[model samples]
Target: MGPKTYSWPVATFDPLILKQPRWILAIVVGVVITLAFVRLGFWQLDRLDERRVANTTSEARMSEPGRPREGVLGEHGQEVNEMLHRATSVEGAFRTADEFFSPGRVVSDRQGTLVATPLDLADGTVLIVVRGIVPPGTPGPPAAGFEPPSGSVALVGRIDDGEKPIPIGEHVPEDGHLASLSRVDLAYIDRWIEGDVLPITLILEEQTPPDPGGVPLRIPREELTEGSHLGYAIQWFSFAIIVAVGVAVLVYRAGTRAGPTEAFPDGASRL
Candidate 1:
């Protein structure tokens, strides 16, 4: 028998998109990646704006002197719009038994706690006043310096809405001790508290008698400077830009089937 022969055809690149590896999938993936990054970039910008507004409000409040408490907190309840962070003077007698301590606070560059005591006002209404800061780990029923003075006392502090407390089922405050708590919720605490308490709470600033025994009154920072937010925003935008550039490069490579340029890589092309 004559020698048998076998032949195989040479392989060549096809300029047909359909034949290409997951060409449709590639386009979809590219669009998704690009859009996701774009969304993140926009989110950062929004957060940056919020931070600026908050800081401005704080600075404005700090610049002014104390306002009158009655004017800010009328009989109808706290004038919500004008009371937050408004420094004011209040006169009342301390209800020591009703005093509760908010543990975990920082003062004078040191760890401490807050004295949340009720004050019996002249109008027979009770007001929640954060007496002042005391070293943390102090048991309930505050000691001398941290306690409010007996008899009539006029003190100054910034009126603020107490923080919201943990929801009813989530938190159970320890008896004779208030620890591991989050905020000073008026509605929640009012249930167990006595007397007609004011809606807003006072951050102890100054008292007529011996000093408050607390460091000078000042705002505790709740949010970080915008500089950090700005930095993060820039990073998000950078990521988006990178994703866009990568998509462009991929599309270009896929379209040009030749070493540098040809056409879309798909089905076979006619000569």
Candidate 2:
């Protein structure tokens, strides 16, 4: 007998197969996931733009000549965010008796505490001044010379806003002063100061009369830099593309595979 020939069914993809309920559901799910990832990428881009604008504003404000305390605070209705990082000077006497400390502060990678003291401004409005960073464990008054200078003094600092208050459990008071705080939440510190306290605080940069001992180390101005937003955006965009291509490949494979009712042999249909 002559050599026998065998016939085998060949796989073929049909676009109509994608219309089936399962494929349709898969396609819809894939599309939704892809769109969500794309939206997240754009959100990160928006964050980047905001950061850039903030950096520009900070650079411009910090470079200009320092404004007097009144000039910085006199602008009616100006929010603390708007004035942040701007250079300003104020003449006041430190109310040492009411000083408190914010622990877990870091300067040059060294753990420390921020000495927060209320300054009696010339206009009678109290201003919270973050004198500087003291050793981590130093509580109430910073041990002698590190104490806020006595009498009237002039100070130069950058404008900063108060931090949001944390749970009261972490902010217990001690002898009219807080031994430590999680942040400089002025609202909680307001109890120690008399009269109206400004909504902002100063990151003390310089004082007319320097403390010879320099117990509390001066903190450097924070450097502005774009964070991981761009990288995160790229990752999200990549995920979207991957999901799109993966879905397409899966649909093609599924459609080409054999189904219950399909055409196999030439001009013949499988039962």
Candidate 3:
């Protein structure tokens, strides 16, 4: 009845279980993962190159003088993306009462409204003219006695392709009064103006001074930056490399290990 000693069984690890077959499988998986990562990295690099080319082309086009041309109004559909920031001259009388104001356009630390007016060409077809940006909170025509150009005047502006109309709530009118128009819908404007309108819209580059309000027409500078696709691609590739390396290390260790040894009791000695 000295001390009641209890002995517990010890567990042994079998290194042979991780044999050549298992090591081979691990190497194969590791190589596959590494290849996948390398492919992803190259794909990211390709996309970066494409973006660089596009940015360079756009900047070069913007720096040159815009093209100015005159043609028959409202003849057929025309693609406007090619003429963006390019100069175009139009001779038509500005429709005063029909001027539409687009609010909430914030650019270059200045908030203002984009003014859109229908230009009645000599041939009776209408051209939508964007008369440039005016300062926010400016009193519109009726409120400040604003008066548009009288007779047919020369106009020059950048061509902007129309986009889909912004969705409105139920409280907003669908057809009647013009409120804060978020997007430019050329088809809707054509129907509203009741004529064959030009597919391209002009952003007015020059205009007369505002009537009573202190609003001045201006253009905001746009700042561009490189996107994060390259960074994401690098991360994905790095992950794949890590996975491959981890598997390789495991396989290498397994290949170099020795067989397992039996365990003995605490008091036992090697004989």
Clashes of each: 6, 0, 1
lDDT of 3 by residue, 10-93 (tens): 344445646668666777777888888888888888888887876676576557664544532232235455555455566777
User: Comparing candidate 1 with candidate 3, which one achieves the higher lDDT?
Assistant: 1
lDDT of 2 by residue, 82-159 (tens): 788889999998887777777788899988887878899877889988888888666456434587668898999999
For residues 14-84, could you state the per-residue lDDT of candidate 1 as single tens digits? Answer: 45754566876776787788778777767878888987887778667756787677765563254664567
Query: TM-score per candidate, in order?
Result: 0.74, 0.86, 0.63
RMSD of each candidate relative to the true structure:
8.5, 5.0, 8.4
Candidate 1 worst ten-residue window by lDDT: 257-266
| Candidate 1 off by > 4 Å | 1-21, 74-81, 167-182, 211-224, 259-271
Tally clashes: model 2.
0
Candidate 1 Cα deviation (angstroms), residue 192: 1.4
**Span of 10 residues, lowest total lDDT, candidate 3:** 68-77
Instruction: Give candidate 3 misplaced runs (Cα > 4 Å).
Output: 1-47, 71-77, 139-147, 167-175, 208-215, 221-226, 246-271
In model 2, the clashing pairs are none
